[model samples]
Target: MQTNHDHSDVTVRRDGHIAIVELARPPYNYFDETLIGHLVAVFEQLDDDASCRAIVLASQGKAFCAGADFSGGPTDPQMPRRLYRHAVRLFATRKPIVAAVHGPAIGGGAGLALVADFRVTCEAARFAVNFNRLGIHPGFGLSVTLPRLVGPQQAAMLLFTGKRIDGRKAVEIGLADVLAPDGEVLAHAVALAHDIAASAPLALMSTRATLRQGLADAVLAAVDHEASEQEWQVRTADFAEGVAATAARREAVFTGK
Candidate 1:
């Protein structure tokens, strides 16, 4: 195994033909513009490495990613726009990604997970698209990717309700590919990456490219609309109440302002 030293928040290690990219933020791998940018850089570097045929995205901590930490200061309406731009770069990378969803992937965190080609999750893992619950439109190109993975109706249900589902339910609903045992999600994800890496590298890239053709473009367009909606929604009274309610750990009382 060879360790590729890079940015602080993200790290990459090589195991034969697969590159394991890990998020170093622990407990809750909350993302921001800088973390997303580092991820895009690492993924692009992996794309240029010929020996790296597949990538496994894993995170250290109790939760895979608990979403953005909007705890302090006034919410920056433009942050999502900037972060979404960085996210587009992630979708543009030309490498197979298998995400290890060992824990919670909520809100934008779930969007990050969807950037991968496949996801391996455990029964304890939780998946949710809670942007609507946050009183904002979905960002991170989830409008296109979620529907692409699970179809329009299922995507609508998940987006509109902002419901959290377990790994078994996620697999059943097509949100995740494989369901691994608790404590072995990363191992299974790496094994899946290895399986994908076994194929001819050029052929693998070609087939993946063909399959995901125009996906990045679709995400680009979707995020534009999503960001526009979010920009306005974030200014609403309901959004304010939603954030407060979440921080208080209670159901939100939305006034529909």
Candidate 2:
């Protein structure tokens, strides 16, 4: 038996003990506060459902998530705070999540992937925490999550330089747990989730709780600082130049302002 739910750009479907939650905005699933909120709601529901032991997080898109849609230029100045506020709820979820990243997961998208307990990716997958490149401090709790996965040195390198890394490099740096072929990322992720789901449910939840203790609180603290820094950074001239340069596909020339 399968159960499906439609929540605008997000979809949740159950397959036995495994739940597959997908982001439905194809080509590039750029998220906003509403999208994050929908995801959190789905996770919360799945948490209450005893049948959902583990979750596979996938996307129908060229990029698993390419971060926020900046094509409309700067969004509401308060948007980052609101978006991160919703995002913190993801960390409070109870079940394990395996993210299938088939393409670029950039900026806040990278933060979204890190919210999962594990990540599955392919050679085609690209990961980047590019807030610095965009002339803003990293948000979505990446400062906490990225370092927790890849160590502070590697996390700092990625965050400070805003460099994009492929799946192999991601695995090497501990950003991803498993590697799959280009088209099979989601399959592998689901398989991993199934393995986790096969374990004794109570023990699994207990072990996971111990392993992830205090993580939600850490993300909460991180997002607060991230949001505050981003608020001021967004008002800088360098931020404007960064956005313009990215849209133009040119190198940004930032002046300290």
Query: Which residue runs does candidate 2 get wrong by more than 4 Å?
Result: 1-3
List the candidates' TM-scores in order.
0.98, 0.98
lDDT of 2 by residue, 226-257 (tens): 88888888888988888899889899999976
Positional deviation of residue 79's Cα in model 1 after best superposition, in angstroms: 1.0
Model 1, position 25, has a per-residue lDDT of 91
Instruction: Estimate the TM-score for candidate 2.
Output: 0.98
Query: What would the per-residue lDDT of candidate 1 be over residues 155-250, giving only the tens digit for each residue?
Result: 999999999999999999899999999999999999999999999999999999999999999999999999888888888998888788778889
Candidate that scores best on lDDT = 1
**Models, CA RMSD each:** 0.9, 1.0
Q: Write out the backbone clash pairs for model 2.
A: none
The lowest-lDDT stretch of 10 consecutive residues in candidate 2 is: 1-10
